[model samples]
Target chain A: MSATRRIRFTLNGQAAAAEIGTHETLVEVLRDRFALFGARESCSQGLCGCCTVLVDGHAVSGCLFLAAAADGVKIQTIEGLASGERLDPVQEAFLECGAFQCGFCTPGFILMTRQLLDENPAPSEDEIRHYLSGNLCRCGAYPEIIEAVKLASHKVKSRTPGGAAP
Target chain B: MTPFDLVEPPSLGEALKLLEPDDSAVRPLAGGTALMLLMKSGFFRPKRLVSLRAAGERLARIRIEPNGELRIGAMVRLAALEWAPEVRRDFPVIGHTLRTLANVRVRNVATLGGHLAHADPHSDLPPVLIALGACLVLAGPRGERAVPVEGFATGHYETVCKGDELIVEATIPPLGRRRAAYAKCTTRSADDWPALGIAVAWDDDGAIRSPRIVLGAATERPTRLKAAEALIAGRTLDGALLTRAGEAAAEEADVVADARGSVSYKKQLVKVYVARALRAAGAGPAAP
Candidate 1:
């Protein structure tokens, strides 16, 4: 055993720092140091997406990442999706559609969807299902979740004004 | 969870030095996808972890050599491969496999070397890499040496790599006109390791040259089905030939029973996926 190492990175939009052990997971660090409880720790084996987060704009499981690996990287947790109290369109759609049942898996679903839309603005139904395949909704709210993503796609496309529908 | 010292080595040289002692209580940490879970579950207890993150440059780049071989940095995440244009254009099969791998989140952090080194029977990389005739470049006190992917995994959760050696990159020979495909049978669309995976590739002239067939989650380590491959090599693929190849693969593989599927079911799946992959490799009719 050794003293914890100091790690520095960008969390959401702010500079973040934490002292963590070599074996500490990103989910543990995010939940403990920054108090971002949104990155849940369910099934810490990386089997479940309850610990999903965005690292450098790419979705990843926090439980599978070493805390030290986040050094100098840009991270976006569920809390980072909003800007000045305005929820991101995907978040709003999830809420409007009641896509979450237990809410325990909402953050992971939201983050996964954000990554999916960023890569493909208007993904097909099959693509949406494929991309969100890792984030398990044990409560079986899949239909609502798919509908919410479709609604969010429409909202994003319509707001582009003259942009073509994705 | 047990606490341990974290050392971020700035380069591969430094990382190897940290593991120089054959019995040193240190492990090289990659994506930590498997390592993290193992540690958390109390399966692995190392005194120190040499973080490979600082060796970032070594892991993020993909280069093609003048000899027409493709070199992938050991650290290249699975997601990066899925999104890389060159990989998609030249090695569409690689992208296809990555796309089906666990999930988007896992792909974002899981590194190629880590996955290969983990040597899990059900892992997605081994079968594909072996089929592509890929080789791994390892660096250590003994300097760099290349090992064929087929011989890299010695057994379940085991590899030929020495404790001090670090996998720096993987080299995949160009496919040129060869068409390739990968198919797997799993319980779910994501997060579950395959019950059985099959990879197939053939050379130009459509003669089924350089045929390599592999099966995962069926044995202690991902293995090549030489008997099945022998059935098609140097012969033009036809309906009867493809069926015979699939049967040979099923007979050659040592499939084990798991929760996802039974041994008998896996044997059937081996035949089905092998046939499908061969057909998908352009052995069958094309869309009208």
Candidate 2:
């Protein structure tokens, strides 16, 4: 039998720890160990972005990333998009734009969208498509997802000081 | 997934000490993008995994030496390399290839050393790195040694990297006035792996001085078209010369039929893309 390792990392905004096997992926640990089921485990390969999460403020596939490797890293999952009752601007925009159909890939899109908005508050249409191309939507909700990103970008900028829609 | 012991060594020296040349069961883990998949699929069943993230800050940094050479650490993520200003300005081909290497998510964590060591035939970096004349640095119990990227990969999913040796960094000399262009032909969207990839570079005179023509993804490893390069050397870049050079590249490439494409189909792609890449490099840098 293989020995288990204790991993310490920041999940959402809280410090978290888990005793997991060396081979366990972040998606498995997140969904099974900690019961944070926001990130889906569709395609375990890195090709699919269903397991996308923010690692150190950048989006990455959780399924392809080992849980033990995430020690001391700050990770943001789909469950963290809302604070208490208030939803993040991206989350709010996702709903307003009706960005999901089957909803299996919504969490990944939301997390990736959050990352995009955080990095570039104002991204062009080409930039948006280029960035989000990794995350696949099986329900063909990409059109709405793109719209959500645009809407969220506007909402996010409007709330910032000295920022307004041009 | 199979069970394995995880050892997080605090330094490169310590990690080296933990490795043994005869211990094939001990594997070094970096980024975990490709390795994890293999482990999960039961294709690789290593008994122990040495985590390199514990090598700390030094191994993760991309350094520009005083001599203007670029040293990319083994742990520097692909996304970081893609947007790095030095890479964009000095080695734009590296950045250009990185943009289309994989999707945004994979780039966020996949590292250069891991990618090179992984040595997947369809990967984008090996061909470009070989074209740039980059050297890979490997550290082990015997200390560090350098190997040219061209000779790094021995076969599919294989490299000169021994079980005890770990790829620590890749150093690239200054490009100077040389301009490079890379073209990839994928079966589907841009996100898919290349069915055929072509990387071409030329000197300031634009006369194919020390020309490098590489065709990737069609063979077991990145194949250099030395004959094609020789044919174009000292010759002006023109449609006729380029088409002849492309035909030579197609002939030299040992293409194999796979799910991505057929052997003849890939050879045809190599012929067209080699010429297209040479023209593109001669024209100017395409917008990233």
lDDT string for model 1 (A33-140, tens) is: 888999998987776789998999988888878787788899999998899899999999999999989999999999888888878988999999988888789999
lDDT of 2 by residue, B117-159 (tens): 8899999988888888889899887788999999799889988
Alpha-carbon RMSD of each model: 2.4, 2.1
After superposing candidate 2 on the true structure, give the runs of residues whose Cα lies further than 4 Å from its correct spot. B285-288
lDDT of 2 by residue, A1-166 (tens): 4568788999989999999987788899998988888888897787768899888899989998888778899999988878899999998999999999989999888888888888799999898998887788888998899999999999999989898953
Structural similarity to truth (TM-score) of each candidate: 0.95, 0.95
Tell me which residue pairs clash in candidate 1. none
DockQ of each: 0.72, 0.72
The local lDDT score (0 to 100) that residue B106 gets in candidate 1 is 79
TM-score of chain B of 1: 0.94
| Kept native contacts, fraction for each prediction | 0.87, 0.89
Q: Candidate 2 chain B: worst 10 consecutive residues by lDDT? A: B279-288
DockQ of 1: 0.72
